[model samples]
Target: MDYGPVIDFHVHLPYRYKDPIAAADYLVKKLDEANVERAVVIAIEGGVESFKKRVNPKYVRNAVQEILDYVAHSPIRSIRTLIFEPDKGIDEHVQLLIEHRRRTEEVVKAVEKYPGRLYPVGSYNPDYGVDKVIERMRVYRDKLLGVKIYPTLHCISPSSSKLYKLYRFVEGINGLVIVHTGCDPGLWELPKMCRYARPKFVAEAAKKFPDIPFIIAHMGSYSAIMPGIYFREALQAYNVDNVWMDTSAVDPLFVERAVEEVGYDKILFGSDFPYLVGFTIEDSIRDILKLDISSDAKRAILHDNAERLLRMLGRL
Candidate 1:
C-alpha cells in the first residue's frame, strides 16, 4: 500500500529526562524511516502525576523546553500543539493559575521562535470558571490552532455548560478543538474520569458549534471493549461535517468501522508516538495500510485529510 506522503496527525515528543535535541532527532529519524511527511507534535501536559500532585514548575519547564527543541530540530514539516492542564479541584487554585500562565508564556515564546511550526492550544477546567477560561483563550487567540479538553482527566462532561464559552470562543476564531475520548488505560485508578470519556458528549458540542472542527482522538477507542461504544457515538455525528476522528493507537477494527460509518475524509492518521510505548511508527502506519478500505480512502486517511486541516490552519 503506497500511502504517498503521509502525515501523522497525532504524536508527542519525548519528554522524560533525555536530551531534548537528541530525542527530537531520534523521532525525526523514525519519521524518515517510515516515510512520514509530517506530524502534529503535541505537548503532554497531563499524565499520571497530573491527577495526583500539584503542578510542578520544573515539569512544565521541561515540557516547554522539549517543545522548543523538537520543533527546532524536526526533520520534516511539523505543527506544534502546546498542551495545557487547567486546575480542577479546589486544592491548588492559585498555584494552578500561576502554572497555567507560566506554561502559556513559555509556549508563546516557543511559537515566536519557530513562527509557523508551533501553534498553541488552550485547556480549561470547569473549576477555573468561564471568565478565566475566556481570558486565557483571548490571550492566545492569535497563536492557537484551537483548544484541547480531556473530560476524562478533568472529570467534566464534554457537553457540560462550563465548556460552551470556550467552544463559542473557538468557533468565533474559526479554530479547531481536539477532545480525548474513549478509555485511557492509564486512568484505571480514576474510574470516574473514564466514565465521561464518551463520544456522545462530543456530539452535543458538535451540534452547538457546527462550523468549528472537532477531532475525537482515538476514534473513542480508549479501552479494548469500549471501542464499539465510542464508534457508535461517533457514528451519530456522521452527518455533522465539522466532527472528525483520529486513528491514534486504536484497534484497526474500529479504524475500519470509522471509515465505514463516517468515511475516510473524516478520519486522520496519527501515531501517538513515544506514548505508544512498544509500537514503532511503522506499526502505527501499518495498521491503516492493512485495513480493508479503498485505496483512495486509505490515501485520504493517511495524508489528504490532515493536509486539508493544515491548510485550514494556514500551517502549510
Candidate 2:
C-alpha cells in the first residue's frame, strides 16, 4: 500500500533520562526511518508526574528533573501539550500550578524558537475552579493549538461542568481537544481512576461541543487488552463528526475494530513514542500497514486525517 505521507498524531517528549536535543534527534531519526513526515510531540511534565507519584512517590524527583532538562533543549516542530493537574490539597495544588506554569513557559519559548515546528496545548484540572482554569487558558491562548485533558488521571468525569469553560475556549479558537481515554499501564496503581478514562464521557463532551475536534487517544484500549470499554464507546460515537480516535500503543485488533466501526477518515495514526518502550516509530506505522484495510484507508489513517487536522489549526 502506498500510504502517502505519514503523520504520527500522538508522541511524547519526556523530560527525563535523556538530553532534549538528543531525544528530538532520536525521534526525528525514527520518523525518517518510518518515512513519517510529521508528528505531534506532547510535553509530559505535569500529567505524568502526578501519575508517577501515585504509582511510587520516589518517581517525583526524576520526573521533575527530566522535564527541566527538556525545557533546556532545542525545539522540534511537534505539537506541545502542557499537562496540568489541580486536584490536590492546597499546598500541593499551588505547587502543581507553579510547575505547570513554568513548563508552559518553557514550551512557549520552544515554540518561539522553532517557529512552525512546535504548537502548544493547554491543560487544566477542572477542580481548580472555572476562574482559575480560564486564567490558565488565557496564558496559552495565543500560542496553543488546543488543550489536553486527562479525566481518568485526575479522577474527574469528562462531562463535568468544570470542563465546559476550557472546552468553550478551545472551540472559540478553532482548536482541538485531545482527551486521554482508555487505561494507561503507568497508572496501574489506580485502577478505579482508569474507569473514568472511558470514551462515553468523551462522547458526551463531543455532543456538547459538536464543532470542536475531540481526539480519543489510545482508542480506549490498553496494552493488548481486547474490546476495552472505550472501544465500545468509540464505536458509539462513530456518527459524531467531530469525534475521532488515535491508535497509540493500542493493540492491532482494536485498531481493526475501530476502522470497521468508524471507517478510515476518522482514525489517526500515533506512535505514543518514548513512553511505549521497545515500540519504535517504524513499529507503530507498520502495525497500521499490516491491517487488512485498503490502501486508501491506510493512507487516511496514516497521514491524511492528521494533516487535515493540523492544517485546520494552522500548524501545517
lDDT of all predictions: 0.65, 0.65
TM per candidate: 0.73, 0.75
lDDT of 1 by residue, 36-118 (tens): 87766554334334454533444333433544543334332211221233222222433333332323334444335444443
lDDT of 2 by residue, 102-218 (tens): 243444444454445545555555345557756766777777777777765565667778788878988878888888887643222124546677778888889999989888888
Off by over 4 Å in 2: 1-3, 17-26, 45-102, 126-130, 186-191, 223-227
The per-residue C-alpha lDDT of model 1 at residue 3 equals 54
The per-prediction CA RMSD against the true structure, in angstroms, equals 11.1, 9.9
Superpose all Cα atoms of candidate 1 onto the true structure and report the RMSD in Å to 1 decimal. Answer: 11.1
Model 2 TM-score on a 0 to 1 scale: 0.75
